[model samples]
Structures are given as structure tokens and as C-alpha cells.
Target: MQNASKITEERINKGSLLALAPIGVFLVLFMGSGIITGDFYKMPALIAFMVAAGVALMINPKESLQNKIDIFCKSAGDPNILIMVIIFLLAGAFGSVAKAMGAVDSTVNLSLSILPANLLVTGLFLVVCFISISMGTSVGTVSALTPIGIGISQKTGIPLELLVAIIVGGAMVGDNLSMISDTTIAAANTQGCELKDKVKMNFFVVLPAAIISIIIVAIMTSGYQSASTETYSYEIIKVIPYLAVLVGALAGANVFVLLAGGVLFAGAVGLFTNSIDLWGFIGAVSEGMAGMQELCILVMIVGGVIGLIKHNGGIDFVLNYITSKIKSATGAKIGIALLSSIIDLCTANNTITIITAGPLAKEIGEEYDLDPRKIASILDIFASCWQGMIPYGAQILTAVGIAGVSSVAVIKYLHYPIFLLIFGIISITVDFSALKKKKTH
Candidate 1:
């Protein structure tokens, strides 16, 4: 009996620090080369992911070469990666077709017609927040708004990266607060709380942060009030595609279907305006798919490489270390946040990060008599904040892909996520008033 117990206790967790080498290799090769060249985007993101994936494959030397290949292929074929690729394709098609139909310009000029130039950033941020809240998907929000942001930047001569960052911040607001968001679902489910309760609790905490962000944007863009020398000759009819797409998305239409519908709507408008014919519309779609090729490739490679890291217990090792350090209620909350943050850093997918960290967070919360609502809120908020800030995270990557810039450029202008993260830490550490209502069993 003693010998058998010893054998059971000796079980090894596959986790190793060396499993992290691929990611380190990627950042060095990608960012180091960029710094040396003084142009961050000169080395394509796809190339970086490619080399990193190669390193990931080589790291598992104990596995047969064929077995390692199987793991990569399976990870590449993961449902999440496949779904994102589909969305990328549809988003590209819709963006290109709608732009060709003049929808993007029409939408930008239409906003300018109604809102003051200084309020453009504020207006867009609120728009994305509302839309994302309704749709419950940050990537969808970014894809829909990034073109408009790019268009507004073109017309207003603002930095394109700044606009992309602004849109991403807005998207994070919705992702963090939305009742139906995947992060919200994972957190609520794992913490044994009602989703509605989680939403109510989170709103109290994050609303002040939202207000702060809007104020910052207003102040930052105030100078633009005196600089508006541009005029728009936008056609109202041409704006229908953007309007339809926005309305469809807000109504909770399936994202892929929503984007496809927008493309067909744009094509019809294009045909009427002589902007495009059958061949031209088809060419636009092909061109759009071509545009997404690089981003799609990067997503698949990342999914596979990260999957290998997960399989090798790299993520588990980190999770264990973070959980091992908790000693108090505040420490538990902070640990939960840090746990989510670290998992998001490794996964690059906020929803998956929440799922991975939520169970551990729940146990920590229970141990400390922490409120379930607060735990859920921390998980979602930190995940969204981390996802929005990380350069390689899906939210920022999608925005960067659309805006055609390095993620570093956009990270500097992210007002909402930075303020949200600060407020999240403050709410837990300094003021638990927002969470004062006891977690009623």
C-alpha cells in the first residue's frame, strides 16, 4: 500500500518553462527585427507566426515527427480558429464591397453632418459600445467600425492607428459588459451566478471608467473643432449598406450571415451607382478574400502554436503558480484578475481565457467568501482589458489587420482599456462599495 501511494504521488505534470520558447522566439524575431529596421510592420505578422510555429513544432522532440505534425494540424483545425477565419473572410468581403459602393465614406460624412468634429471620437466610441453590447462580440464590433474609423481618419487627417485604438476600446466596453458575451457567460457559469446579476454588478464598476474614457477622448480631440476644412458630398442612398449592416448586427443577426448580407446589399447599390457590375463585384470579393489571407494565416498558426503550448502544460504551470500565491480576500481578487490576465496573454482569446481561469477563480472566491458577482466581473473585465491591450490578441490583431498598421501604434492610444483596468484594480483594492451587496446564496 505504501509503495502504490508513492507511485501515485510521483505523477508528473507535462508542463515545462521551455514550452514558452516559441512565443519568446516570435517576439524577438518579429519585434527585434522591427526595432532594428525602424519600421514595425515591415516584417509581416504572418512571417513571425510562421517562424514561431516552426519553433513550437521542434520543441516537442520526444513526440514522433508525425505525431507532432498531427497536433499542429488538429490545432489549426480547431473550431474557434475556423470560425474566426470565416469571419475574417466575410468581414473582408463586406468591407471591400461596401467601400466600393461608397458606404464607408457615406457613413463617415453622415456622422460628420450630425456631430461636431470634436465629438467624432466620442460619438464613435459610444456607437461601438452600444453595438457591441447588443451583439456581444468584440471582433464583430471592430470589423464593422474599423473601416468607418479609417475613413474618418482619412477625411479628418487623424492618425489611423489612434482611430483603430479608439474603436477597440469601445469594443472592449461592450465585451466586458454585455449580457451575452462569452466572457460573461464563462465567468457567470463557473462562479455559479446569474448572468443578469453579473451584468448589474459590473455596470456599477465599469460605468465610471467609461465616463473617464469619454472625457479623455473629448479633451484629446478638442483641437479638431477649429480644423474642420473638409466637406462631404455623400449620397444618402449609398449609406444604406452600412446602415443595414449595423442594424442587422444590433438585431443579433448571425455575424457571418450579417456580413454576407451587407456584401450583397453593397453589390446591389454598386450596380445601381455604376460603382461596380457583376464582374467588378466578383472581383471585389476575390480581392477582399485575398486581403484577409495574411490575417487568416496568422490566426491559424497562432491557434496551433498556442494549442501546443497548452497541450505541453505551459498554461497549466502558469495557472498553478498564480493560484499558489493567494493569502487574503484582496489577494484572491487580484489573483483572479492576474490569473485571467495571464491566461489571456497565453491564449490570445478572451473567451477561452475566461473558461480556463473561471473555475480556479471560483474556488479562490469561495475560499475567501468573495462575492460571486465580483469574481465574475473581475474575470470578464480583466480578460477584456488584457485582450484589448495585447498586441497579438485577437481584438487588437483584427483592428491592426483592418487598419494596416503595427499593433504597437494602436496600443498607445487605448484609453478605455487602460482606464478600465485601473478602475478594476481600484474597485477591488480601494473600494469594495460597488461589490458591497453580499453574494446572496
Candidate 2:
């Protein structure tokens, strides 16, 4: 009986730090080469992931080589990962068709004509926040806005990296707070709380961060001047495709449907305006999908590597280690935050991290008598914070892929995630129960 109990405990706590070495290997090879060369582009992300995937295959001698390959292939073909790849391909097609049909230019011209130069950056940030909240998917939000951001950057002389970072940061705000967002839904359900209650708690925690981010963006762009002296013009007819996609997303239409519709809509407008021929539209789609090929392959490779790490017990080790350190309710809260953060870092997917960590967090919260609303809020906030900042995350990857900028360059301009982190920490360390009571009175 004693030996059986010991075996169960060991199984529960099973994890190996060596299982995580592939990630370290990737960071060192990718980021290290970038640092040494002073250009991240020198080391392609695809090569780094390929090498990391090799390392993952080589580890865990207990598993047969064929089994390891199967694990990698299964993870690479995971439904979520495959869906993301499809989204990337579709986003590329839509962006290409829209740009080819002059929709991007018309939209940029309309935006520039309406918003003052100094307020363009701030306006873009706010618009993205509203759209993302309505859309409830950060990747979708980033995909839709990145082309416009690139257009603005070119016209305004603002750094492309900064503009793309703004889009990503704003998207993350919605990812954390949107009622329909996967992260929000997962967090609330895992914590056994109502979605509305989680949203209320989450809004209060992130509102200050959003406000500060707006101010910072305003200040950063205050000195901006347009790089082009030429006046911009727009054709309202050409802008319809972008408008359709935005409206459809806001209405909670399926992303795949919206992208496909956007592509066809843009092509129709192009044909009507004689902006592109039928062959030209088809070529544009091929071009767009080709552009996304590298990113799609990199995402799949990363998925495989992450799969091997999880299979080898990397995540379990971290979970056990963090839970072991909790000594109080406050400690438990911090532990939950840390767990979410680390898992997100490893997986590079916030929604997945929340789903994986939610049960453990619920267990910890129940033991410490922590509020479910608060627990849900923390999980969403921290996961979003890490997701927004990580270079490998889909949000940042989508932004960079669209904007044609390096992910590392954009990280420095990501203000919202930093502010979100600060506010998240403050919410945990400082008790707001008294403030809630005072407000009620």
C-alpha cells in the first residue's frame, strides 16, 4: 500500500526539466544568432524551429523513433494548429486581393483624410481595441488591421514595427476582456464563474492599463510628420471589401467565411473597377498564400516541438513546482498567474494555456478560498500579457507577417502588454475589497 501511494505521487508530480531543453535550444539559436549578427533576419525562424524539432525528436530515449515521429506529426496536424494555418492562408489571400484591388490604399486614404497626423497612431489603437472586442479573436483583429497599419506607417514615416505592435497590443486587450473571446470563455468556464462576472472583474483590472497605453501612444506620435507631401485620394467603391470584413467580424461571423467572402468581394470590386483582371485576381491570391507559407510552416514546426516538450513532462514539472510553493491565498494567486504565464510562454497560445491551466488554477483557488471571478481575470490577463509580448505567439507572428517587419523589433514598442502586466501585479498585491465595498455604499 505504501509503495502504491509513492508510485501515485511520483506519477502526479512527474516532469523533467530536460524535456524543456528544445525550447531553450530554439531561443539560443534564434535569438542568440540575431543578437550576434545585429539582425534577426539573419537567422530565419523556420530554420530555428526545424532544428528545435530535431532536438525534440532526439530526446526521450524510452519512446521509439517511430512513436516520436508520430507524436510530432499528430501535434503538427492538431485541429487548432491546422485551423490557424488555414486562417493564415485565408488572411493572406484576403489581404492580397484587397491590396491588389486598391482597397488598402482607399482605406488608408480615407483614414488619413479623416484623422489628423498627430492623432493617427492613437486613433488606430482605439479602433483596433473596439474591433477586437467586437470580433473576440486577436489573430483576426491583427490580420485585418496589419495592412492598414503598414499603409499608415509608409505615409506617416512612423516605424512599421511600432504600428504593428500597436495593433497587436490592442488586439490583446480584446482577447483578455471580450466576452466571446476563447481566452475569456475558457478562463471563466475553468474557474466556474459566470462570463459576465469575469468580464466585470477583468474590465476593472485592465481599464487603467488601456488608458495609460492611449496616453503613451498619443505622446509617442505627437511629433510625427507625414513622409509623403502628396495628397491622398480614395475611391469609396474600392473600400467596400474591407468594410464588409470588418462588419462581418463585428457581427460574429465565422472567420473562415469572412475571409473567403472578403476575397471574393474584393475580386468582384476589382473586376467592376477594372483594377484587376480575372487572371490578376487569381494571381494575387496565389501570391498571398505564398507569402504566408513561411509563417505557416514555422507555426507547424513550433507546434511539433511544443508537443514533444509536453509529452516529455516539461509542463507537468512546472505545474508541480509552482503549486508546491503556494503558502497563502496571495501566494496562490501569484502562483496561478505564474503558471498561466509560463504555460503561455511554452505554448505560445493564450487560449490553449488557459484551458490547460484552468483546472489546476481552480484546484488552487478552491483550496485558498479565492474568488472565482478574480481567478478567471488573472488567468486571462496574464496569459494575454505573455501572448502579446512573445515573439513566437500567433498574435505577434500574424502582425509581423502582414507588416513585413521583424518580431523582435516590434517587442520594444509593445506598451499595452507591459502596462497590463504592471496593473495585473498591482491588482494581485493590493487588496481592492474595501474599494468595492465603498463603491457599493
Q: Which candidate wins on TM-score?
A: 2
Of candidate 1, the 10-residue stretch with the lowest lDDT total is 1-10
Q: What is the per-residue lDDT of model 1 for residues 361-400, given as tens digits with 9 covering 90 to 100? A: 7656755677888888899988888888988777888899
lDDT: worst 10-residue window of model 2:
432-441
Model 2 agreement with the true structure over 1-441: per-residue lDDT tens digits = 123233335547488889878777876776678668755446776787788889889898888999999998998787766766776687778777887988766765665566655577898888788667644678878987898788788887888998998999999988876655667666876676666567777787778989999998888888886565556698989877766775775566766787798889899999999999999999999998898798678667766877787788876665456545655678879998998898777657786567556766876675566788889889998999999998877898889988888999999999999999999999897754332411111
lDDT score, candidate 2, position 136: 60
Relative to the true structure, how large is the alpha-carbon lDDT of every model? 0.73, 0.77
Query: Against the true structure, whose lDDT is highest?
Result: 2
TM-score of each: 0.63, 0.64
Model 2 TM-score on a 0 to 1 scale: 0.64
Give candidate 2 regions above 4 Å deviation.
1-13, 116-208, 216-231, 327-417, 424-441
